[model samples]
Target: MEDNYSLYEIAVCELIRRLSNKDDCKRYHEVLGYQHRLNHYIIKCRTHGEPKEFETQFNEIISQLNRVSLLELNVSFNDICNNVSREKQDDVVKQIPFIIVAMTQSEAAKLFENYNESEKLKLLIDSISKGRKTTHFIRQLIERYAETRNKWKPFEKDSRTISDIINDLLPKLIKILFPIREEEANIDLIPDYYESAFFSSNLEERSEIRDYFIQRDCIFIVDTISLFNPEIRDRFLQSQLAATKPIIGILPISKDSMAACEIIEESIKDKFEWVYERYQRKLEYNCSLEAYSLPSFNRWLYKILPDIVKRIPQAAPENINKMKENLKYNSKGFQKVVLSMGGAK
Candidate 1:
């Protein structure tokens, strides 16, 4: 499956999606034209026989990438976390529509496990950041947890924040765990979120829909539990669109994934249209609501890519992290799962 990458096709579609906004992805129409035509050829490759004309499409991408200074649609953890204001985070989210990978509550919990911390943080960061990649910090992360010297105690709360970790958890753990000054005990840069931010049985619990700079590097439940409620639906939608931190709902490849978005119309009183496109090989699926759009088709391609989940590579930090940065999405539950894309960042 590692060899089954549709690299050219994915790159072209990603570029085209970046150019669509007309405001931020500013470039001559030629780049956009090639993207559309390239996507057309990709769909044709799916249906009809592969076209030799694909060479022309690939060539056009290379030329435009150089001339237009190829636009990469990415929002960093620092992009939102660096800013501590409601207005600034809102502006960032507004400028770049955050991607949501809708999935089940149990899946979120599985990812929440501490054993998966190293790989989980990498996957969430890359996906929410729209394939921003670059996860060299993972090696340091494993070392930091090793310094903890004790097992990660499961906190039974619904969620946690940077404030909770730094002010409370880290200090206590650092006394015995870290081998540095308390003030300068540099924590691993593996950003994280606790359990599902929207998971609740009642409106009281549900109303705590978190969205801010604090929630910037988080992954939580985006299941139907909160999606069907009117207020929760509206809040969740707003968070996805306006929060500096991306909230992609990575749903399983089931009807629930489809209904997750469709229920938006049922909860609200508007007619929301969801447009989706099937990428090459019928393997990847991407969708978005016209009223509330995300960055790109791949942003909505939330499925675990084939071959992304496999045995952990040898204990070499630099090569492993470089391999991981390319990966956009990876499912949890593997022994040590890390995300790796087909190319360099």
Candidate 2:
């Protein structure tokens, strides 16, 4: 049960455990091979069949696969959640702040503008200000503000003659909102404060902020692969991978298209494969560049549930039995699985 085991391996192990007779192992292996072949067939058939006919056949095959996979694994909802939590907690050295970096300066600017126009920044400020009278609140707020600006939007608008809105406003606001001690007020650190408290001053400033987070073991989550230009993507990959912290780059691909993966590989060359292989070995899941459809994801979930159940320490016998029963009936569709797991709120 090393964390490096893939979901596929976990599912296969669970399937082996559920076999009543040891002789059935060969039959089960053959079935698994058949299912793998079927997956490839379905992928191939996607380009050939007539729209309506293909849809019907695809749905049927997916449903059948889901059923067989669930029956073979026989896991519960509580078990899946418990295992996921345990795996997740193993990495929780601290609450690693996920800084989501956009693919381009324009996108980053848009996101930053959105935060200004929207209630996000206001809400964040309000939450931080409420019910806490700690001496470090101002420092915390400054750090958060600086981090957000650097991660989301490092480039200043060329059209703007003035500095950033937050940059111009913070000093005055800090003086008005925070009671400064006499000793603190006399210190001539306004220039240094401004430099440390704001981003968009220079490229180096942005990089410094990124390095700060990396040193703290923060996870940088890049938004999407579809939006990245070659230069931006390469720089991002270089910076993120060079860091001691973990990076989770989400490639939002179409249901059955490899365009995203192709674009990524084109951008980063063999580095894409290298990162993926590293993820598979260290992160306990395959981050291989592939177009993962909804059905494929669901099938994975179905297979892994039994292994998850086995990992949960406090699972009551009756509840575990009920979960297995639910899985037997509800594993046909992802929606059914959700509903079977107490309607999923």
Candidate 3:
């Protein structure tokens, strides 16, 4: 497998996926082209043929990514893995995305494991944020989990907001662990829905929700007001300050919202620098992962180019680069490599 695809092709593709948006991938698509090149260099590594589904998938994902803020697509860290994984799983070389090689094997394992478990995604994310190695099978497990997760379900309309994502998961955590509850446990005459109440944008309509929390003597939910609209950011803070007579403990910010626009613009610039930094952390993460995958492809190509050079390299320098570029860069490289090898086989 190393002889066929080369780490260069793998890594480059991973990086391109990170940088490319709908308007133009430019260098991003180049990585996919390199994947096809790898096939020509090594007989076994060549693709069987182009895949129709991949074209559709790439177009759809890239188009959506272009429309939204690039910052939001920080989740593209797993794009290369997700694309490859969507194919089939049983057959694997390292059975890990090239990025996995960047992490220690144990760290890789934890990443993959957490990635698979719904409960562990937050924990895994926290670990990654802290720069901790949370697993050993990161690479292999990424391949398995990426494919498993990519079995596309329709997008839920409610999932458009950051709050929606948290709401979907938070309730499950509440049910099983019961980690957070009121200090003085009391069965309320009316249910406590303070979390939802405070975020209401309509000032006139928020009276009921504000009264609900005050009635419960809840001082703050820790950064809860950070989720409010920009127009109301200050208003919410002022109201909360006035309403809570005695200053209490800190409010907890939702982990997901930490990277949100509201939080980023309003965040303590020094403490959470990544939130405000010019570089997109997600894109950087993807690039780092791809950097790790490159050497493997280089190692593979080092072995195979001798044979192919006679026909291809001898033909034209432009052809060589184009072939290599396509194999290693383009989305079709996935199928291109297989077909390239199948023709040789």
Provide TM-scores for the models: 0.21, 0.28, 0.19
Off by over 4 Å in 1: 1-192, 195-215, 219-221, 234-245, 249-345
**Number of clashing residue pairs, candidate 1:** 15
Judge candidate 1 against the unseen true structure and give its global Cα lDDT, from 0 to 1.
0.33
Among these predictions, the greatest TM-score belongs to 2
lDDT score at residue 333, model 2, on the 0-100 scale: 15
For all candidates in order, the CA lDDT equals 0.33, 0.37, 0.31
> What is the per-residue lDDT of model 1 for residues 183-301, given as tens digits with 9 covering 90 to 100?
22212212123323443444454345543434333332232222333444554554442232322332211233344334433333231112112221232232222212222213332
- Give the TM-score (vs. native) of candidate 1: 0.21
Q: What is the C-alpha RMSD of each candidate to the true structure, in Å?
A: 25.1, 25.3, 29.2
Candidate of highest lDDT: 2
Error of 2 at 76 (Å): 34
Angstrom error of the Cα, residue 342, model 1: value is 18
lDDT of 2 by residue, 146-219 (tens): 22323332112222111232233323333433344322221110111122311243567667766665444333
Q: Write the per-residue lDDT of candidate 3 for residues 199-285, one digit (tens) a residue.
A: 445666567655644543332222221222232344345355323221111112223433422333344233323322322343321
Worst 10 residues of 3 by lDDT: 92-101
